[model samples]
Target chain A: MSTTNAVELRNVVKRFGDIAAVDHVSLEIRDGEFFSLLGPSGCGKTTTLRMIAGFEYPSSGSIVIHGREMATIPPHRRPVNTVFQSYALFPHLTVAQNVAFGLEMQRRPKDEIAARVREALEQVRLSGFADRRPRQLSGGQQQRVALARALINQPEVLLLDEPLGALDQKLRKELQIELKSLQRRVGITFVFVTHDQEEALTMSDRIAVMSQGKVLQIGSPTEIYERPTCRFVADFIGETNFIAGKVIENGANAATIETPDGLRLRGLTPRPVRVGEPAVLSIRPEKALLLAPGDARAGHAFAIPARVELVSYIGSDTRITVRLNDQRTFDVWEQNTLSTLDRDAYWQPGEPAVLVCPPDNALVLTE
Target chain B: MTLNALERERQRRERRTLAALLTPGLLWLILFFALPLVIILVYSFMTNGPRGNIVWQFTLGNYVDLFTRSIYFNAYLRSIWISVLTTVICLVLGYPLALFIVRQPPRWRTVLLFLVLIPFWTNFLVRIYAWQIILANNGLINSALRSLGLPPLTLLNTEGATLLGLVYGELPFMVLPIYAALDRFDFTLMEAAADLGASKRRAFWRVMLPMTMPGVAAGSVLVFIPTIGQFVVSELLGGAKVDYLGNLIQRLFLRSNPPNWPLGSAMAMAMMLVLLALILIYFRTTTEEDR
Candidate 1:
């Protein structure tokens, strides 16, 4: 990723009559970057990607690819290609023909077309399967064919609309890694759209978290994971415990919040919080530790009382759900790193426990 | 070994059930259709009676005259010409309309498809007759032209009129099949093509046209077969100017001054041969991709 902007959208808005499928989205995708538009279905991530690919004309504003304005140009005239989620391999063409379609459209010679096709199929590791029909290939092979077809065009940017969405779990994971490495090898900017948060975090150099046709945050995986700007981002990206509170003391870098149950908690904030304003304290499950009474007093910043309601033994971690004194629930994820220790057996349901977290790790955000 | 034996017994019982289910349709076809075809084949070789009836005497003269007679041979050519024209015109007109209908919203698609089938609800002959009222020189169209002080166009009793009637009669066959193909068509392929640097026109030709070829072939066959042997449209619209294969066949069997049963049956057999040849040629020549 570099400072050079390969693709830029300027306050682009797209409306399907009354529904704004993409609303005032403006973001710059860096050169050679794997940028993701991540959100739930109908959250306008796909719509945003479509607008950039020129399949859709934005209702307002403009899109520029490689510094050229692309607002009125049709998809065919644009200098970008897309891998449709369905693979969309031409049913009439063999795998070789499908990959060579763009070059043939450009009027390349037969000799060059053959060489480039072989090279493209080689990149996707499908060199031997040239004559096979698209229907003759398995799902993963078809996906690779789609990728090869788009990449062979050598556009300034490549648009992928959830390309691995239709594959099985194991195949999807395998393709996720393959696709990321493939993007790096080609060094062409990739604008990937997916609703799967884990997939986005795993593959994207930067992610544009979206909801309801609006971009919520644009950041790296660690930034999005540890320092989310809002409660929605925190909850959507991973499991989070939202503790309802009101700001009792505002500060430049840190603030104190009074929980509804009368317990006071302090946490760091990137943005200033006004005193007496309603807020929510966001904390990740793994950050919240179950204390053995006096074990947390020397270092932990805050402590609250809770009764264990349930304990789930996940292989890598032990998850415990505890109900706070005022009936609000809290979740704690304890890593089962100690050999020969079954943590689920240690935490009895209905037993009283203390939940503690380091102050710097908690995120306090205004609702 | 016991499991294999049990599976074989299960397969035997399933075959018996399938045979029982197929018995009615197979019997109906053999008794009603096959028997009539066999009788017609036999009748073609027999001699005509003294009073325009079958005499059951073996003769080859009818078959000889079938090719030597110019009127009968010419009718077959004319039928081929008219059927080809009808198929082409129906395809040219129906494709865009079917493409338009498929793009409609799901709710509107149902309504448009229903509209495509609406003409079938009325009696077929009654609807054909209604075209007579509309296409006549003194019909509603010419009358409207006259009221506008425009010169009235000759709209009926010409080859153009016959062609128009055939095309109109077969249009729905073209539209419905193309529509069905477009209904199941994956539209995203068109987008993928465009993204691959194909212009809108190229994308449509390479992707949309080839993808919908099955529907086009089905619709063409539907329109072609029926119009080739049809006498009604030419009879009503041709006004004695057009004598198609069907008109010639009817004259042989039903409207002959003294019925030549063997000759008529020979003409019928010749027509069936032409029809069979056409279907074979069509299936052999078509370029649909094999699955």
Candidate 2:
């Protein structure tokens, strides 16, 4: 019922036969915000976007777009447009005709349609290629045409279903910035669906991470990556090293878990945990630092004495595998800040090191 | 210098290979098709003797006769009209049927396309005779009408029956090409059109029809070319009541007394020119769409 939201799905469920493709899901997408549904294939993200576009009707509950209920509406009647993953540009029409199609269907004046089509094509930077057929254009150019074709309508909400999934890495990166800025320029709410976590983290104002037809978490990129509340979100968002232990103490702000070796680990808990419950302490590889043994690094909550088993020097960071006291292999990423090729400057195998676990960086998560 | 010689030797081998691969098809066409067409073109201008023989004297009298005679002129018009009408009807009926088949599940699509091909298993002449049995005064339809206490109307040997037979025979040609086009068609374009605010009907006209036009042109050529030159349907179904170009050509060559082979050759050449024009137009339109 809130008009401020560009799109609202309230307990929506879409079932194909007896299996639920999209389980009961509720979401409120803020007007003029770039929201993304991030999930792997078959996670119901595309189905949810299709329901909002009115291509698929929900089996239960309601979908409201700009205060209008849209379960029974067809895609054409809905005040929204989708940039399909395949670009789906009409092969028969020229670029200009394709961009002008929505205006033509609205019965707009021919001169107006022509002007707007020119402006829209220019917006996509395809002004010089108006008369060319779609087959003649390159894939990136075709994708831009698809964007212009949808954006020319200026709908209440623009839905993009993995539009950049077909582009090469360089082009995807270029268009990611272009699309984010274009959303800002047009000031239209965009509901983007993508399986690429880095893409969602880079472009989305807020992301809803889905799995098995349910939204596991909905937060900004930093919030989802840094402070994941559940085990799935913690593991799915980034590379995380987990320590399985039973909860020894549950407090208001943090929880403590004891490993079988009687080593206690304390971490911030986003959700409440009951004492004596089995839980996992999730720590990202980048958050942990590796120091020489007996270094006594200040500001470190807990330091475990371990031996560096393997070391890999990537350009940005050096990934080190260290063995903990309980024989569990822990991954630690040390940023390569210094410019040096000296072999002595890096950690070598069998070097005894201390793995510093920061108090604020780790999260205690339960299933 | 050695590399240059090697490249030259490779090019010679390639040329020989190309000639070897093309020789059979080239020889077949020149002997069976090109030679007959040249003979037809040559005989179209030759004189016709009193006893069904080609005379040595070269003349343009057959061409002049074809242009001036009302029967040939009317037959040309009627044949063109019937062929065009049949192609149009096949297109209108076949597009929907092809779309229906394409929309089915993969298993059902195979089964439905099989059903379309099942009629081809029967002989074309037998199917035309089947149509005759269905359309005759004492045939299936008329017999049913008679049993219903209704008057048995004349259904056989009419233009409608002839048209029905032609369309029924040529409809598969139209449907198969359209089905192939629809199968290869990316249906996501329909969803794209819908997302662009086009109604389902508008989407079909703007996107579906134009995209599948190559198939339409191909099917039209396949149907029209054969239907225009066809004599059996009109001969058996129309009972020689209407004189089409095919029937006129047949009568001049074989059926008429002291048959006029030169006139028949002239008529066949004219029909070929008309079909050549149609095919040229078809190619022009399809290539323009590609551009």
Candidate 3:
């Protein structure tokens, strides 16, 4: 990707009367980046997307798109097109006509408009649906038509506002793959807005995790999932066990915290070194290993004595709800790669086990 | 065999219930609408007696007289012209109002609709007379003009006055249907249009206008047909001066020395035919959107 940012929001704020829908939010969406604004509903992700699309103007600050200031620019005049959450296909128009609407608005040659519209439809794998009305198509087909309509414009930035949100899980997965590859082939900047963290992690190169109208962290999926900077970021992205604690020993590369029940947790950290401060140890269930009694220990792995509160086989993984000796509960996810045919040897409810998670896997956050 | 017998009994009972459900509406149409139309048709063929009573003799004279008279021909044309004007005015005013109402917050939408419907609480005739007071030369409007030291223009008993009254009376008819269409409209399509580089004006024309057209068509039909047959507004607001079909029909039926029941019935039949024809044309133009 080029050095130029495709879009930039400089401390943008949007207020709905007394409430700030987007509050002093600043971010850079690089050119050709599959950047996503990931958050729950009413988190200002969609509002930020709308502001970039020029459907909404920020109450304060400014948005610049492709080196041009987008302040006061109407949606149509901006060099960006959005695939709305509802798909928003024009019901009166045929699929081809809807795709051609933008080029025709710009008064392009009829032949060019027709050619581009056909190409767009083909890109979305909807070539034969050109003459059909929007209402005549299935929801997935209509969604493809919406994508084709926006893409046909060949705008600088393509926005998608939870475009796959309404689809069924299987259909959403299919579209996620299709959309990611489409973005790749087009090589256009995509600023997707979605509440589904899994969808964001799957499709986007970088995600901006947001909450309460503010961006908490912006990082790659691995970075975000592995080392969330705050409790909300750690909690929002995936299932994590947050054990409240006080920092006992702080090192340059690692920190140890004493928990409420007097259990100490040592974890990796690149943040500040400070002792006697409130902290939290974030551990993903997948990263925490469950070892039956008398199992050989990895020298660097921290082991905790716990009893299974709940045990359920979930095909890919066995989820064990464990209550620790410290009187705190934590969930440990064990991949069921090993044969579970020996039902008697399997960890039953109330069975004792050692929760062995590597120290490096834990993230100690002092936020 | 026992199950089959029970199923047959249930089907018979269900059929009886269905018949019972349909009877009231069918009976009402027969009693009120179909019977009145048949009586009007019969009256058109009968001769008028010296008094207001109908004569038993069958005659084609009423139809013949209606066709031959310029006063009746001119009156029909005038009413059609006035109705057309009123419908057009209503459409022009109602469309933006419907759009505005639909875009308002959900709480204000009901309040705006209530405001549109509030005028219906008063009797329609009483409302027409209120318009007369507003339009009269020495009434509220002209008096305001006179107090401003401006020359008081003739306001009542004019074509403008009649047109204004017709529009005023029929406006709610137009607004309601258009509002209903807008209420069911999905605004996302308009946003999509704008996102695809259509200006506000272009988006409205390309998206908003076409989708809401069914509403306009329904509203126009509602306003046009009734406006053509209206008599009271023309009488009060036009000060009985306008030669509209409704005023002319009223004169022929009630004010003549011998009430021309046959001639009036003939005129009414023709007016009904015209209304039916207009509706037919409207239906022809708008096939079900099906989209």
Best by DockQ: 3
The 10 consecutive residues of candidate 1 chain B with the worst lDDT sum are B282-291
Superposition error at A198 for model 3 (Å): 1.3
Give residue A230's error in model 2 in angstroms.
Answer: 1.0
Candidate 3 positional error at A341, Å: 3.5
| Residue B230, candidate 2: C-alpha displacement in angstroms | 0.8
> Candidate 2 or 3, higher DockQ?
3
Query: True contacts preserved, each candidate?
Result: 0.88, 0.88, 0.88
TM-score of chain B of 3: 0.89
Q: Which candidate has the highest lDDT of all?
A: 2
Model 3 regions lying over 4 Å from their true place: A291-298, A308-311, A338-340, A343-353, B1-32, B42-69, B258-262, B284-287
Give the candidate order by descending DockQ. 3, 2, 1
Q: Each candidate's lDDT (Cα)?
A: 0.89, 0.92, 0.88
Model 1 residue pairs with clashes:
none
What's each prediction's clash count? 0, 0, 0
Clashing pairs in 3: none
TM-score on alpha carbons, each prediction: 0.91, 0.94, 0.91
Tell me how many residue pairs clash in candidate 3.
0
